[model samples]
Target: MKQKIAVLGPGSWGTALAQVLVENGHETILWGKNPAQVKEINEQHTNHHYLPDLILPTELKATISLEEAIKDADALLFVIPTKAIREVAHQVAAIVENQPYIIHASKGLEQISHKRISEVLAEEIPEDKRKEIIVLSGPSHAEEVAVHDITTITAASPELDAATYVQELFMNEYFRIYTNDDVIGVELGAALKNIIALGAGAMVGLGFGDNAKAAIMTRGLAEISRLGVALGANPLTFIGLSGVGDLIVTCTSVHSRNWRTGQLLGQGKKLEEILNNMGMIVEGVSTTKAALELSKQLGVEMPITEAIHSVLYEGKDIKIAAKDIMLRDGRIENEFS
Candidate 1:
């Protein structure tokens, strides 16, 4: 259809997605706050700081001015961190004139409100200026997607047509997009899996084997589905691409910042030091806090999330936290009661 799309945030994921859109023959403009990075993308067709060693498509344009990027754009794709979503959405809301399809690739609940990204977007963007928000999520890494590796993801919206539109917009030979109507499940799965990924990485750092990783991931899915269902999400969505699929990729892949952050923690590095050095947002760190709060408020017994929260925020030693999780009272595996 050759639509003009404005991608906010020139991080690894945003740049990779911008590459996909430009290659799909859309007028894709990537907007970043950093002038240096924008200049690099425009002049050299590369974003070395984020997607290092990967050359972006020449047709992909980059800009520093948000107004220039969104002017006359048919859609706006946000790929920034979770904490930045509301601020960026507020900025877009103030200036966006056209009724563009509001789409977000970022995952994580709002820490203060425990609201989903779409919920945050809907709260900020006036109803008259945007269509139903669509969330793009699944087991995808920016490094892999930037190189055209085979990848599959889901575009979820309550409005079926909106999901299908995103599916058509991004689908290609190497990248496949599926449509799901469970926005709640999709967004929760996408956010919660990162917490488990941190745990999986911590297991590795603590010298645990595949058995520990498998247990954390399995039980983590149980916790995620429990909270999600309590919040009105379809239980079936937890097993789909955005659920278990995202869990496997993020927990096992080296490209996951959350996993890497947990690994550093397991290796005895402090959170502040690890985050300062990583130079990328580790979403699970903040998501752990939000999930812990949600668990307490909803009376959801998420032992794993609680354990991770204790380690991350309560100054509990990772070893003791792991031991505590292992020693919790055992119950029947599949009892959702």
Candidate 2:
């Protein structure tokens, strides 16, 4: 039962997912924009730019050409950054007419339009050529997923069967998949939690212990649930794998790009300098802007998101933002579940 799966964007997540598919007996071709990444995956059997230590399966091939990757594929997994989704979708639109089941592993809204990744795909891909849209997200980090470690993730779509199919596609002894129909909730939770992770990393960088990190994580989830609920997603989704599960892993794991980015900033690196140094997508910076915009538009109270926004966008000092949050008037927390 080997199916052809094309994964666009051969960064860490894409490479790891392709590994899972290959191990599961799927023909996975990972498409990378960078020639070196493509060469590494095809020749060296490892994407040195992303997952340097993990070896890729021979069933997993890499190509720089989008046409070669998507041309006769059974499934298409969009593993690119949120900022590049629309542009990349446009590149593949003509080739995507094959109507392969589409899966998105990206977790941020478009910075300019404020549209979710799913929504962006709907706009970029031709309506007549559309297929089932599925989202794969959870607390699973690429670093752990690349290795043979236990990880649980959610496969969500409005269509139950689509979710279940993806769940079966990736599920294995080391990987557990849960099915959910709350696509918006899953996407929103995935996008916004990165912002919270930044805050948690700031706490770590500031020498705040476990108690402070847990509190920040809890409050950060509350903000995510609020905005998600306002936009027609199930509130309870914030309690599940795509929500609280994702928040915990990203906030605590050193493998998280969002958390690491914030840690550097908390250690006093300028935003521009940090971005230049990483040379990869941090995701949280754009997500913070999108969440801040979502809060303003929906009139939701998200002080934590706003605080992070100020630190990242307004050039406010991280310490000043921390003090402001500490001094803000507080009240009893209400469980949204």
Candidate 3:
């Protein structure tokens, strides 16, 4: 029952996922654009650039060549960031004609296009042949996952069979997988929570403790729910693992890039300087821009998202922005409820 999985974009998340597949007795080929990293992974089975201390399992093979990595794989896990997914998808499309069902673990929409990762995949891959697209997402982080820690994630697809199959493919003792039909909601929640996570990070940076974080998380759910409902996602889906569940974990975890990025901002570091030094992918940085545009197009009231956008892009001071939000005219509670 071994699966041939080609994990593309071998970053920390991608490397961790490849590790999981290998540990699960699956044939995994992990590919990266960096030749040095790929060579090291193939030879040493260690991604020194990312997970420096952890040794990759012997079953995992790393490659720099796209053709060699995905040639005979049964599935492709799109683990790249939103900004890089399109180009990688295009490259994969060119190399593989009869390909495996592409599974994406990325968690952001395109900033300029504001398209979901799935939509970006569809645009890159050929449409004539039917493709089974499944998304694996939740609150799991790469660091914990790499260490073989127990974690729960949700698998979603429009097709029930696809979702179930992905669940079977990824489920294991340390890693648990759940199935859901709420693709739109799952995708939206995955992408949007990062922005809110940034907000939560800012709260942490400002030394605002549990009460502020709790308020931000609850209100952030409201923001996601409003926008998600407007975009045709189920209102209640916001309560699921991909929604409020995912939000709670990402906003609070120090491992979160969005939160970390916001932390620097909260500590009065410039966005450009923080981003330049962060090294790893901070998704909420770009996701904030995408959500800002999406909110405008959809006419959703995303106050937190809007505030974060202002701070990140418009150079609005966080202190002033926070004060402005607090000073807004009082409104009836549970208006959406």
lDDT of 3 by residue, 1-337 (tens): 8888899989988999889888888999988888888889888879877887789898789888898988878888999988999998888888885658889999998978998999889889876433688889998888899998998889989888888888888788888989988888999999999999999999888888999899889989999999889888998889988998899889988888888998888999999999889888888889888888888898777888888989999999998877777787777769962
> Each prediction's TM-score against the native?
0.99, 0.97, 0.97
Ranking, lDDT, top scorer first: 1, 2, 3
Better of 2 and 3 by lDDT: 2
Clashing pairs for predicted structure model 2, backbone only? none
RMSD of 1: 0.8
At residue 178, what lDDT does model 2 achieve? 95
TM-score: the better of candidates 1 and 3: 1
- Write candidate 1's Cα lDDT for 19-50 as tens digits: 99988999999999999999999999989999
Residue 149's lDDT within candidate 3 is 92
Misplaced by over 4 Å in model 1 are none
TM-score winner among the candidates? 1
Model 2 agreement with the true structure over 241-280: per-residue lDDT tens digits? 9999999999998898889888888888888998898868
> Which has the better lDDT: candidate 1, or candidate 2?
1
The model with the greater TM-score, 1 or 2, is: 1
